[model samples]
Target: MRVTELSFEGFRNLHPGRWNPDGGVNILYGDNAQGKTNLLEACWLFTGGRSFRGAKDSELVQFGADYAKLGMTFEAGGREQEATITIRQRRSVTLNGVSLPSSAKLAGTFCGVVFSPAHLSLIKDGPEGRRRFIDSAYCQLKPAYVGALTDYQKALTQRNAFLKQSKELGRCDSELLDLWDHTLAASAARLTAARQRYIHRLQPIAAEIYNGLSSGREDFAIGWDSPIAEAILPEMAAQWLDALRQARRADLAVGFSTAGPHREDLTVTIQGQAAKAYGSQGQQRSAVLALKLAEATLLQEVTGEKPVAFLDDVMSELDTSRQDYILNHIEGWQVFITCCEPSTALKNTAAKVFSVKQGVINE
Candidate 1:
């Protein structure tokens, strides 16, 4: 997917303006905190109406403004499309002039993979960040996964509340607990199966990309950690139910449901060593870049359209070799990169460079 046009009003420090981007590499260069990332965030909003920076909707509004408005026109799957989002007390989304009931419906309409400074910590950070990476990519490829994830979260929340109440009251209702257990187990089974399949498919792709990034000098592997081991859904559900039953007493004592997909993790290892603990800073960054590229490839493989790439100043953290590898690899996809300086190497490539200053964009 390539964004053809992007417009924003009352967003961060940005003045109301529209950007017409080239289908190839489009570079936005500016000093720090001058709305360069803000422009990329606007493009991200078209994907699923959620900020890749994890900003709250209200926080995206400009100072003294009541609301923020964003519009994007993109080409995906051989068709031109438009999406708009308005954020006030609540957020609203529209596609092709028709109002959408929820932003969840926007999935797959436009998809993108983002790389930012925050992503550099994926290896050093906890498992939650890695898990989020998987879920975010999977949700875009399979929208039904969103429903399953939501249902599982709801059931898990309700189950935890019941556990807390039972612990407080010193008594538990077996029937009520059974209801939640069944729901949780069923949903957990589905989630585990989907995650395992995704990881299995992603491992080789990521490893190959990392190999190229490292010039074939290192070995990389990814593994999924889960409580359920059975390959079949029914068997997995049964295992989950059994595990939950066995852990009920401990869970009650702790006032939470402790055995579920929410507690699972993804492991990245280099040459059989835990990447999180043993990998160097450069290694970790390479792993993350590989993962991001693999995610874009997976999205294209499943969706038949390349997702736009949003690089938020991550190039500054990489060495010259890695930077060149990335710029060379992302040839067919539309890329929006934010950087402080225009690299001399980029001059020979087909790049549309723009300048950002004080919320204004100039070609």
Candidate 2:
């Protein structure tokens, strides 16, 4: 997919204007806090994903502005389509002039992958980061996964509230707890199956990319950590319900439901050791890079259209060899790169360069 036109108004520090980017590499260069990342954030929002930077909708509006509006025209699946997002007291999304009931409907319409400074946490931070990485990618490829995730989260929340209330009252209602347990088990089983399948598909691709990036010196593995080990969905649901019953006493003591997909994690290992605790800075970055590249490839293979790539000043964080490898690798996909200085390698390529100062963008 390629974004042919993008327009923004009252969005962060970006000037109210439209951008027609090159279908190949388009580099946006500017100093820190000059709205370089804001431009990319707009593009990411068009893809139905939450802010890669984790900014709230209220925080995305410009200073003194009450709302933000973004419009995008892109080509995907051999056709041209338009998407519009308006953020005020709430968010409203429209595709092809028809209003959408929920933004989740926008997934797969214009798929893309993002690489920002925050992504480094996927390797160095806790398991929540890795879980989010996998879920985000999987949701785009399979929109039904979003419903399963939402259902599971809702059931988990209700179950926890019941646990807390039971602990406070010193008595628990077995029938009420059974209701929540059944609901949680059903949703959890679906979510666990989806997550396990996603990790299974991602492992080989990520391993190959890591091996190439590391010159076959490092071995990479990805695994899903879950309490339900049954391969069949019905059996998994039964096992989850049994596990929840067994953990009720401990969960009540703690005032929370502690056994479900919400507590699960994704394990990344290098040379048979956990990467999060043992990998060096360089190794961690390499692993993250491989994972991202693999994500882009998987999206294309599943959708039959290459997802747009947003590189938010990540090139500056890599060495010359790694940078060269990335630039050489992303050939067919439309890439929007933000950096302080346009690298010499990019200057020699067919890249469209833009300079940003304050809120203005000039090509």
Clashes of 2: 0
Best by TM-score: 1
lDDT of 1 at 53: 78
Indicate the worst ten consecutive residues by lDDT in candidate 2: 316-325
Scored by lDDT, model 2 comes in at 0.89
Give the whole-model CA lDDT for all candidates, comma-separated.
0.88, 0.89
Candidate 1 lDDT over residue span 1-363, tens digit each: 889998999989999989899999999999998989999988887777478778998899999999999898889879898989988988899999999988768877888888887787788998788888888778777778989899999999999999999999999998999999999999999999999989988999999988888878999999899877848999999999999999898999999998899989989999899999999888988898899999898878887888889998867767776777788888888999999997766555689999999999999
Clash count for each candidate, listed in order shown? 1, 0
lDDT of 2 by residue, 87-112 (tens): 99889999999999876678888888
TM-score of 1: 0.93
Clashing pairs in 1: 1-306
